[model samples]
Target: MDLLHHFPHARQRPLRELLAEKQTWVNQDKKGFLRYRALLNELRHIRATWLDLNSDVVHIGRPSDLSPADRVHLQAALCSLKPWRKGPFSVFGIEIDAEWRSERKWNRLIPELPDLSGKIVADIGSNNGYYMFRMAFHHPTLVLGFEPYVHHYYTFNLLNSFAGLSNLQNTLLGIEHLSLFPESFDVIFCMGILYHRPSPIESLQALHVALKPGGSIIVESQAIPGEEPVALFPEHTYAKVPGTWFVPTATCLQHWMQRAGFHNIRCFCAHEMSSEEQRQTPWMEFESFQDFIDKDNPGLTIEGYPAPRRVFFAANKN
Candidate 1:
């Protein structure tokens, strides 16, 4: 409680304070936690009394997050960087936008994705191998990445080299060249590259070829969301101009999975944003995040994924 009270906010936190400042909600949570703790203890005692259970019940002190040596090192690091701003930016972009975000986000995708324990994985359209690296970092098993862009393939190779991830293997290939894979890998990450293909369904069929039966795919794509399909991702859809490709809503996405010889399928609505929110987001592909800093007028910035928000789908090959 003391540590939480003194914990610092590295970046601006507006919504957190606003929600907490409301006296009605604040009073409820404060009173609620105490009452809940008391109720839990009472329940425990009652159960113990009924069961005649007692081992001289003792209170165990919870361990601190930072050990004594870790605290010492942390203090030394803090002291060494006295003024703190060695580089241009003081806070990361994620930190700045943390309060504006909802709980449902892409950050959880990598962790909540199915376990790859004793499993091989494939990362399709593995641009610079971001999601693939996540699998390799967490599971440390064999991973294969298929990338079409030659420069991006080399960049992925370089990043893998620096990461020293020995189990990861990659080749310069697209969904079209998936015949190179002999129908293996337990899990596949298909993210940020789905809508780029002219026929998204065709790409899914190709991805299915690389995955073993019962293998799974965790997907995140630029979705065209509405009651009916429309031309939303036309201008900067990335693959082709006036792109005829369709980004299936959650319902349509499910239908496609069933048709693709996949089963036991489910989906997650990963990214969500309002029209007003979309305009505020910076474009990482164009320039560094710092280059687009409009701190004085955050609302004025115009540019980004236009049709409000997008969604991702997670499905299986079986």
Candidate 2:
């Protein structure tokens, strides 16, 4: 937890201090908060399971290195951390098939982003640091991930400890906290988060402020198919899921970027989310996209809104 070691200039306003300021809200008596912390600490106590860092599956340990008892212990520990929403990780030879096939998003966005090698990157709304770890593959100088949810934050640490990724740091913070950051990042990745914000424009502005001058940003979000510039503002929920505010068209998203003071905005790719891309697995056994989609017509949600088609847009801070 040495924040200063990674960010030497943060002595004036350290990440630990920021988290301390929000201690009351973060440590509120939310369900499973204490248990999640306990599990994370317990995981840290476990002996390091040696593994490779640069692999497609995020290999954590060789199967032959562990005894039968060790494998069982590792599986039990990992299972305690349920509903892993953002990964498809291989830890200690056990495949934690997460809810979302994140690799698909990575595959789409990587081609659209600038080379991350030696770049200081930040992943806003980093769920369990999945994309952050993937970003490390490009050999970034440093990777900082911000996740507000305590459970996901702890999970990120547990995985980082197991993976031994010294270059990556996952902090318990949110996009709102980005205002406290200096204009330091070379690149920022914002995915599956814009629609969740009540003020998407302001969120983009915060991102714009956080980036170094001439830095780049990658935005990926659900899109309502259309050519005209428009965004769908759902009343309460879209696809029976809450907190989904505005699903914008690609053109609409470009306009938001332009409004946020970003130049060279480009909506590079848009693709429909598939069942195979997000489904119930051993690690995350819950309602999935199939349940939310219109059974009679797969092109729309059960509520008759357009189905989830994600789009990626890249822009530069001018």
Candidate 3:
């Protein structure tokens, strides 16, 4: 599929330029690209008879649609993309119970979501397009997902190929690329991405620049427990995740949005993370939240840091 064709005409030229630069970096690992190409080639042949995005488990096709041999082939193809991080998708009767029960998080945010009908939306760090697929039910004019990892980018493409959600599109891009989309989006979902950035405030600033006037940004992040407006700059890793940087208090996160020039900032939800929310599963059999936290004390991580908590906030551009 010509991914560029899905983008708006006004963005086509600059997006082309940006993708060309990205291609240069991608080309450095020709073998990995070849592997991804082979995977996509294998996936294109399998098509879903029907799909339902509105369900808790995003359902695609049914068992009756595929022969026994075809089901085996499909399962093998999906298993190749291991460590599924953000989903509980059922594709053609084969269940993919991913590491995170993403539906739980989705349910928390849905009540607070702005009406998305005909709006242009962006989901930053949209791993495997789980949220993007869910957002499709809202009848958005367009829902573009930005996920930089090649594994996830291809996974989303493969799923969409069968589900065929015309309004849902994805790109091999991350939050750093938000500058290319100045004032282009009506709503941006920046979930589970802020704490990963070394400079959280600057990342929020980029999100601010990407929104149209009066646009809203919904931010969900790993936060520390406290009422004080301060952040925990981890000396090393937080919850055994090395990429984590500043785990902020709920108040501190709101303050970050305020500093980023967002107005009417409101924190709608705040809750501690749990094994039930994220854990090892058949589809994602690896070290999970259970292994990261202290068995003796759930309130603290294995590294002795405050245990993981996720906080959700919504703010608007002036």
TM per prediction: 0.54, 0.91, 0.94
Per-residue lDDT of candidate 3, residues 19-97 (tens digit): 8887777656588777766777766776778878888999988888787887787788899888799899998888999
Candidate ranking under TM-score, highest first, comes to 3, 2, 1
Q: Pick by lDDT: which candidate is best?
A: 3
Better structure of 2 and 3 per TM-score: 3
lDDT of 2 by residue, 199-253 (tens): 9999999899888888999999988998889998887789988989989989998
Which candidate's TM-score is highest? Answer: 3
**Candidate 2, lDDT over the whole model:** 0.82
Residues 1-318, candidate 1: write the lDDT tens digits: 221121132112542343245323323546543443333333221111111001111111112433455445434432322221111111101111211122233355645577776677777776545445445545646776777554445444533433445567665556665544546557877765666677777777777776777878877665554655443444443222234356566566667667666777766654544433222232122232233323454322233323324666677765
Could you tell me which 10 consecutive residues in candidate 1 have the lowest summed lDDT? 46-55
Q: Show the lowest summed lDDT stretch of 10 residues, model 2.
A: 3-12
Candidate 1 Cα outliers beyond 4 Å, as residue runs: 1-106, 228-244, 273-308
What's the C-alpha lDDT at position 83 in model 2? Answer: 87
